[model samples]
Target: MRMAARPLAWLLLLGILLVTVLPIEWRPVTGEPANLERLVAFALVGFVFVVGYPRHWWLVLGLVIAVALGFELAQLLAPSRHATLKDAVVKVAGGSLGVTAGVAANFLFTRLVPR
Candidate 1:
């Protein structure tokens, strides 16, 4: 059961990465609050790690950073998608924040429910 859960968690993490990196136009919204998108991105990634790899938060965190870096490097291959230090920074920050949240959640959950 534990083995199966781990793979499922990884798949879910991959799905989140795909959804995030895919190109999508930002639709214009009337008076949308600032930083909402970033918050959502961070929360979603953090929640995935928290629920998926509760015992290996560090691994998940490292994976997030590696993946983000890989994506940024890949962008260089596309003439239209040049790599930007700013984007990389944002990605790293988001991933780091997410991992922190996941770790905290894992701690709380473990304390709340012995396993």
Candidate 2:
């Protein structure tokens, strides 16, 4: 599970970067609010990252936030996209929640499992 999650986490991050810097018209639509999409995307990535690399959870979290911020900043070069603090904040919040959940899960698993 951990082995699979590492690649999955990186793949998700790549997808996020592509979606973020693409032209607005080229972006996919889920009929959901854009902010929700961003939140969920970052959160899922964060959780998988922690699961894949369970050690140094704090570093994983910081890297997640950095990715969020870097992606948002990348928008400035997209011509059709713009960077905003509000969006960055939302991404960060989502990533934080995911990291917390992953850490808790790890904690519980270690406590309950004999090995």
Best-fitting candidate, scored by TM-score: 2
RMSD of each: 4.2, 0.9
How many residue pairs of model 1 clash at the backbone?
0
Error of 2 at 46 (Å): 0.6
- TM-score of every prediction relative to native: 0.65, 0.95
Best-fitting candidate, scored by lDDT: 2
lDDT of 1 at 86: 70
Off by over 4 Å in 1: 1-39
Tens digit per residue, CA lDDT, model 2, 19-59:
99999999999999999999999999989999999997899
